[model samples]
Target: MTPKQIERIQNKIKKIKRALAADKKHWGGYYHDGQGLRYLPPQFYLEINDYSGAMRYFNWFNKNFEEDSGYPIFLFEWTITLFKKKKVKEAEKKALETFCSNTYLIDVFLGKDMLEFNKNESSNWEYSSLIEHLIYSKDQEELSDFYIWLENFTTSQTFYDFANKFIEIEKAINDEPMGKKRSQLFDEKLKLLESIK
Candidate 1:
């Protein structure tokens, strides 16, 4: 990619990150991706402990779809797992159809297939690296936004106190075997509710 292309993709990433921050309150679930299924976001597939964080991902997804990069479908375990097996089966079918689509992303580096990392593999933290890479090379506004959110959101002593539980919850979800992704999401929602209460 040329300097201009790099800059454009970088800028799109920023918009996505910002949008993700904006809607971090939504629980995970199966969402639409305008055209059949080729353009789907990662939220449609992963289980999330934090509703707000998942919402943020969705928010970014909507923004990205609008940007014509591609639409993202979420596999929000917390929200979608509640459906009956029949429903899940149907949704999964549609999701797979979208997943198999050819309208891949044209971003800075990896396209929409960034979610290809194996969740069960021991070294599958590669997707997180994408986040790190984008954030690591972020320009002024993104860095500032991240700092503000991190400092302002996580600096509370109460939040720090709950960090261990959060970590545990996250680990449980990330370490799950197939068909059990939503197991830890409830614990997280309960924790968030407790915090709010």
Candidate 2:
């Protein structure tokens, strides 16, 4: 929260935003073919209790990228920001928008239904925020609906294609630590897949 910390975080955010701008095609989805933009920089802001900084990242991103292609997780953060600011109606709207965007992939990844399948290569902010919502939700219907979609999608060929690529990529890695992590992740994904019902 010091001036130095703020500057460091701002610099990191600028660097990430520039990188993501250059690689616009790889934005969105559960996987990335390159280093991929992560929710980490913005997440770091949140960790430091810099809610305004986090909102700035989300707002800037939304302005620069298409809603569907921009990181869907940003909406979750936006929703959190809105809620914290006591803009309940706007927060609810953003929350619904977040849930509806990239339905299959986001739900599966954020719900942690097949988290290891993502190789921990992505952000968990969306999951964390959604869990927070679920913890206080007056209605459980949305949660059930989300799992229903996840269960169905996991059974589809689209999900298999995504998983297969992840498997293939991890299998080719020569790094021992990464390989071990991949193996553990693969196992965890399998268990999650089996237990999703």
Candidate 3:
């Protein structure tokens, strides 16, 4: 999600939880009337205590509902983080090979998250959201090839800048640039090229 989308989610949560409304920026959320005025990031929710549940709600929103599957992809990373923390490995391979796979994802995410966007100008809303989702998927080496291809397909020109940001905000989710690991994305397809005994 772009910074604004993240803030919007935070504010949506604020609506469901009133105690959180006191601050304009409750826990990084932006709040105000429908007109969009009179807001604060006061430290009140910190004292109210309902904030934690609401924050968890935000986490849930990220996990279950999003413009795309980035939330679940992020959850996959987080789940991996937990496994690494707990030192568990029994289902690790299954999780990586099957659960967190493009094949496993619903068709919407099959190859849709690779579109590129403008580097300088504001982008169309539909294009921006789609492009943002693609950017988010580009974080992992597993998803890098797709993004690179998308970038090439679109070319690095802002005349057709899809997303509002050149940051490719999707890539921001990733700590490192993804590499060209085509085989990892396909085994049988590669095997089809090999000789059989």
Candidate 3 lDDT over residue span 60-148, tens digit each: 54443343333333333332332333323422322322122222221233354443433322223223333334223445564354435
- Candidate number that wins on lDDT, 1 or 2: 2
Using Cα atoms with residue i matched to residue i, what is each candidate's TM-score against the true structure? 0.28, 0.39, 0.20
lDDT accuracy of residue 186 in candidate 3: 34
Check candidate 3 and list the clashing pairs.
24-40, 113-134, 118-161, 118-162, 135-170, 136-170
Clashes of each: 19, 0, 6
Runs in model 1 lying further than 4 Å from the true structure: 1-31, 34-127, 132-149, 171-197
Candidate maximizing TM-score: 2
| TM-score-superior candidate, 2 or 3 | 2
Cα error, residue 38 of model 2, in Å, equals: 6.2
> What TM-score does candidate 1 reach?
0.28
Q: Which sections of candidate 2 miss by over 4 Å?
A: 1-8, 21-35, 67-72, 101-197
| Candidate 3 RMSD to the correct structure | 17.7
Per-residue CA lDDT of model 1 for 32-137, tens digit only, reads 3333332232332222223354445545544545433232222222122212222433333333222222111112112223433223223322234423323121
